[model samples]
Structures are given as structure tokens and as C-alpha cells.
Target: MTDDNKIVIRERSTPSKLRYASQKLIEMHDQLIDRGVDKQRATLIGIALHLESMAQAAESSAGPNLTPGFVNEPGSTSELLPAEILAAIDVPPYLSTACDTALRVEPADVPDATGWARLLHARCRLNNKFTGAPCPCTCHGREA
Candidate 1:
């Protein structure tokens, strides 16, 4: 704990703690699913999205540090980390169809591309609809 009475978690290797957290999140996910939310979306939002937000908040509060950052180099060029993520996944049919239509249309097809871009980043974390609908980390642009 710090002067502000906040518990600070430093990064370290702890397999048992990680397992415990995972189990607890899974139990919470099951409880949430029982309440009527879709199982896939429930797990994604409850466990994955929440954890990601926590990680982002922790890193943000840590401020600039001499040690290298997690996702990128200490200093790197500007590029869409999120966009690059798209190429790595086997995109679902719904998203691929949307992409196909977008490619055929003119740039002026929609008035506010920027607005749509932000929204897409905020919400559309496409789960893998093929096997298990696991959460893809597409919601990185969310305001933390």
C-alpha cells in the first residue's frame, strides 16, 4: 500500500495467483451468463475487457518509466496497433461481409468515417465465432 492507501501490484511471476484470478473470473462469468446475457459476450466483457481496462489503468498511473513498455518499444513510430491486429485474426463471416461491402463503396459512402472509426474501435471486438467465441482485444481505443 502507498500513502494514498492504494494497493500497488508490481509485476511478478505467480502462477498460483494467476490461476486463482482466472478461476474467480470464470465463476463470475458463469453467474453473469445465468442472468440472461449471451455466454460469449458475457465472458468477453466481464473477464477479458474488464482485465484489459485494469491493465491499461495500472500502466497509465505508473507514468513514464525507464523500463521498456509492454506492447511496443520504449520509443516507436506511429502506427495503428489495433488495425495491425485485424490482419492477425481469422475474421468472422459477419465482419468479413462488412469489410467486403466497405471496400466496394466509395470513401464518401458514409459521411463521417472518423466517427465510425472511433466507434468501431470502441465496440467491435470480434469474438472468434468459429470455435469458442473468445474475446479479441479490439476494444483498445476505449477511453480509460
Candidate 2:
């Protein structure tokens, strides 16, 4: 086929774990708002927005293939109370710690990788362990 006659197809990029988690939180936020329970819980929406921005920033900085190593499922909220849903999707603390760890890692450790790449790899290494877990480098909370 001639180049002009052939169709070009572009594959969609999969979202990183951070993006996925942000989406879940947004979903919960919408549901809570729908039921008139947003009140103090409305922060979920803001957090989700921040996470989306962070995901974009990470992608731009690390390359388009950045993916964190955590799994976040929103599960079935139909049977749960709004408070329960809030508790269920309370991921910022873990993510914050992970981000902190990612940002604080020494550039020398990852050699030629960019800041976002270091974050991505560190999150992967920490995988599903974002809950107050110490960074593998033993430098969680320490400034780089």
C-alpha cells in the first residue's frame, strides 16, 4: 500500500497507578456529592485532581511510559456508607509517602534516569507497600 493510502493507528497509553487511584477517588467524590454527603469529604475531589496533574507531570518528566506499581480498585460502593467509601479510598497518605520517597532519591542511584523515572522505578519497587513503608533506600522522609 502507498504511504498516503495506508491508515495509521496509534495505541492508547495505559494510565499509571497514580492516575488509576485518582480516578477512583474522583468516582467516590461524585457519588458522595450526589448523595449530599460531600461536606468535609469533598477533599477527595481535590486530591483526585492533584493526582491527575501529578500523573501528567510524571509522564512528561519520566517519558510517556511511566507506570507506578500499585493496584487500586474502587470496588463496590453501593453497600458501603459514604464514610466507609472515604476510608476505602484514603490513598493520599500512602501516595504522599511514595512521592516523597521518589522525589528524595539521589540521582546517582538511578544513574542516567530522569527525576520522574526515579519516581516511577521507586514506586514500582515499593509496590503495594505505600502504607508508611520505608523506602528501599532507607531514606524515606530524608531530603535528597
Candidate 3:
């Protein structure tokens, strides 16, 4: 408790809290699956997208200090930081594929020329699929 009517923080965020949050998210995932939303890839994509958004918001609120370029010397060529530019990179190809899967579009619908990129990311071909692409159809993408 504090004079400002807010609880005073005495400890830093711990791994236990992170674990609990992860577990709760997993439980919510299970519940979603039970509700006929069984697309694991798509679910993961959605979660990743949500997390990235949250990270961007945090980075923005923390201002210039959060990026690697903020510490550049006085004579730097540009104001934009390289790290910030990298952070704005588009969603990964596999993640995009997952989004497409969740949206009920065939893999062919996404023409980003990253077919082999999925393999590099180690996100494809986990179970019973010839290519690195998993069975996106199993994840409610067709009927959603």
C-alpha cells in the first residue's frame, strides 16, 4: 500500500508469474479446442500475432530506450533505429500461412514465395504431412 492509493511494488515480476500466465493461456487454448476450434497452427498464429502487438505497444510506451539504435553517437545518419526497423518486419511466412489456414484459405492462396522458408523456421511438417506444411485443414480453417 502507498499514499497514492496504489499497491507499492516490493518485488520484480518472477518466472512463476510467467509460468502461471502461460498455463492459463494453454487452458484457454484447450477450451477453444473443445469448442470446435481445433486448428493448432492457426491458434498459435493468433497467439503470436497478439503477443507481437503487445510487444510493440510495450516498446512504444518505453519510448526510445527499448530499441538498439537509441544509443547511436551524435553524428548518426538517420533517426530511425535498425532494431526498430527489424521489429516492424512483416509477420513470418509460416505465421502468415497459419493465419491463412485459420481463415480457411488453401496454402496456395498465399503467394509470398516462402515455401522453403517454413522449413527454415522449423514450424512445418510436424505430423503426417509430406511437405513441411502441416494439415492446416484439421484446425477449423475449412468450416470456421
Candidate 4:
């Protein structure tokens, strides 16, 4: 596209890192086209290579050990979910006992059924139907 046709993507004043990456992609595409690559293939290859480079940059910039548990993230950026919900979905033997007992416990038994309460709260938040209204579980509005 020409300068006049170039689309301006303004999102919170375009993050510097993102703008740099986008400009690099444009440069790569132009360079490949100059070297006689077909426009479609040049654009595709440029975008793919740029994405791989960005992912590698992010991975190397991240310091320390790989994260533990389900996410295996390098940092604390992963979404935190309740252990109760995790176990409930997988039904691990150890936590299954807790789940069974917790599930049977009354919702009013907050301390005793903390795990169950967490599972219910997580369910309410993650599922769209429940997000519109106050959760009917013990842990609802408690995250604050």
C-alpha cells in the first residue's frame, strides 16, 4: 500500500515495541520483494520469521527457571486458577478425596470447604452466564 493507503493503527498510542516489530516486518517484506520474491510469499515469510524472532526475544529476555504446575510459564504472567478447580477437572486421587468431602460440605462451612468454595467461585467467574450477576457461592465477591 502507498503512504496514503497505509492504515494507522492507534491503540493507546501504539506500544513502542509493537511499532518497532511492525516496522521491521514491513522492512523485511520490502527487502524480500526487492530481491524478486513474489509479493504474497514475501509477506507470508516475512511475517512468520518476524513472529519467530519475537517469540525467541521474549523467551531469552525472560530470566530464571521455567514455571511449575500446569502453565509452565517463565514468569508470574499466567492466569491464576484455583487448585480445587484444577483437581476437580482432572480428578486426581489425592485431591479427589478432598473434593468429595468438600463437595459434600455445606457452602456455609467456609473454612472447612475453602477448596470447594474456590471451585464454585472460579466457575462463576470463568463461565459467562454467571459473570453478569453476583455469584451465589460463598467465595463470591471475596476475591477483593
Computed on alpha carbons, the lDDT of every model, listed in order, comes to: 0.41, 0.47, 0.39, 0.42
Question: Which residues of candidate 3, in runs, are more than 4 Å off?
Answer: 1-12, 38-144
**Segments in model 1 whose C-alpha atoms lie over 4 Å from true places:** 1-10, 37-144
Q: For model 1, what is the alpha-carbon lDDT of residue 3?
A: 60
The candidate, 1 or 3, that scores higher on TM-score is 1
Query: Candidate 4 regions off by >4 Å?
Result: 1-14, 37-77, 91-144
lDDT value for candidate 4? 0.42
Alpha-carbon error at 102 in model 3, in Å? 18
lDDT of 1 by residue, 26-56 (tens): 6656676679665353333344443444455
Q: What is the TM-score of each candidate against the true structure?
A: 0.25, 0.32, 0.25, 0.25
Residue pairs with clashing backbones, model 3 = 39-139, 125-132
The best candidate in terms of TM-score: 2
What are the RMSD figures for all models against the true structure?
Answer: 14.7, 19.1, 15.2, 19.6
User: How far off is residue 5 in model 4, in Å?
Assistant: 24
RMSD of 2: 19.1
Using lDDT as the measure, which candidate wins? 2
Give the candidate order by descending lDDT: 2, 4, 1, 3
Ranking by TM-score: 2, 1, 4, 3
**What TM-score does prediction 3 earn?**
0.25
lDDT string for model 3 (1-144, tens) is 235643222234343443444444556666766797755634444444444434444454456643444532212333433555546665222333444443443344553224323322333222221112223333424431
